[model samples]
Target: MTAPEPYAPAPQPAADDGPTSLVRAAIWVAIGALIAAALVCVVWVLIGGQNGIVGRAFLTILLLVGFAGATILDAHLAPRRPAWFALASMGVWIATLLIGAVMIWLPERYSWGGFSRFVQFLFIVLILQLVLLHVRLYLKAFQRYDTTFTRAVAIVTIILVVALAALLIVPLMLGEYLWFPDIYWRVTVAVAILAAVGTAIIPLVNVLFAPKKPRAAAPYPTPYAVAPVAPQLAAPSAPVADPASVAAPQELLPWPTYVDGATPLPMLPDGSPDWGAYYTGYPTPGAHVFGAPEPTAPQTDAAHPASSGYEGFPPPPPLPPRP
Candidate 1:
């Protein structure tokens, strides 16, 4: 039977926890601020008492509160939205105040000195808030994007370029206003021109040298391929010997497995008495002429002729007769 295929694990979705969400939130906030500013203006025109300092002060407070609220929300909750939020807040703050100032001036209802003083105070407050908020956001941006000296240097260069453009553009735009001195006009025009030029150059410079967005590293290189080794040839085996050609030892003497070692008694060489085996001196029957039996016992001394000295030494007294 064929084997079953192995199972694979499923992949998970990425988390939504970054700048894009904040940017979206900021856009909504800006839209809300625009609506609020329009509503306040409508309320002021319809309500008739809009001419009083009390009414203008209340409206100013209301709009400034909105700006502050949007700033705080953008800074704290949706920092990626800061640029757009800040822009919206500044636009609303500046446009509403400028329109209100012009209306007060044109009607010539409130004393010009009094209105001017109030407007100057209001502008100071607005400028302070804008500077503080922008400073905070800029610092945060710098900290997030720049750690190395090179990164900081790049950031400074971009800031200087933008500043130069502002210096040149603002003065020329306000050139015809007479109350402002020629010196002020010249400075503003110089700032606006320089800032504009710098803005143009910065983009090209950034495109050429800005750090590229980081991407995830590719998965590790594929494992190296190994070449298969050839199988080795085995040596030829030796031939088997025949079993029958080997000899077995006789049953008498003990067999010696090696030339130098002993074995069992049955395997030893035979040495029997009937085969004239040598031991001590003795004779057997001579089966020859005269057919004499070999000497059985002793022959007494012939020269002595039965001498008495041989009585006790008759020696073995003739051995006991054998059957």
Candidate 2:
């Protein structure tokens, strides 16, 4: 009883740690990369350089733009977690670009066979990733809104991009000459250009047309009114009586008795008048006066008074003995 209880630490409230500086810097870096790549690719396309380098650069720019748009949209509009689709797309583009740069430097440094084929395979993979990334971005942006025309545009755009990407990437990757062998690379470049434009435009459209959230309604108060009550009047009191002048009470007359045979009234089993039996033709046995003759059953021949009427009728059977 004398010993003091051990001291306990108080519970601490949860800490709300927001985004760190490093994360903000990384997002800015991604955005800068996207913008720088897009500018360089546009300049390269305008200069009209070698097909191989231009196509690769253009596709890389398209992929970068798509990734950056998705990431920015998610950061602003999405929940706390980053968009996995955008992150994956960005990672793929970075890896492909780094590998391509390494391959270009290696060929110059050493004689290497199959390097071109390897680059072609990498580009093919890049094209696939770009298609998937664009599809993801379109879905993310248009999913929240109720614009039918915009969604339809997105669907059609995605389908065309995939088909064009396939047509351009497959033949070159497989070393097959199916159609338009000379301008095949140009067609692929054109498709990449279209995809980049679409990626840029779709998000802007979403931001412009997105539905605004409705405001909350104010609460209303209900009023109650009470009615006024009327005042009640007291009842008048009776006059007092004089005790000495009060009249003597009169004796009550006796109830009248019914004389026998005075009127033809029906009687009940307890000798009370049965008014119902008197009105009805079929009277009860108690309705008859005492010492009166009992009524007999009517003969069928006497009621009919004709032998021909009784011809078709059968005779009545004898009654059973009483128990």
Query: Per-candidate TM vs. native?
Result: 0.28, 0.30
Model 1: per-residue lDDT, tens digit, 129-245? Answer: 554455455454444434465355545545654454344333322322324667865766665565455334434545556577899998554222111211111244464485577
lDDT of 2 by residue, 60-162 (tens): 5556655666556544542354455445444544444443333332222223324665667567776777676677767787776747776676776777787
Query: What is the lDDT, from 0 to 100, of the residue 234 in candidate 1?
Result: 22
Candidate 2 wrong stretches, greater than 4 Å: 1-113, 176-180, 183-186, 212-323
For candidate 2, the 10 contiguous residues with the lowest summed lDDT are 224-233
Could you tell me which residue pairs clash in candidate 2?
A: none
**Model 2 lDDT vs. the true structure?**
0.52
Give me candidate 1's TM-score against the actual structure: 0.28
Q: Give the Å shift of residue 78 in candidate 1.
A: 4.5
Q: How accurate is candidate 1 locally (lDDT)?
A: 0.43
Stretches of candidate 1 exceeding 4 Å from the true structure: 1-51, 75-178, 209-323
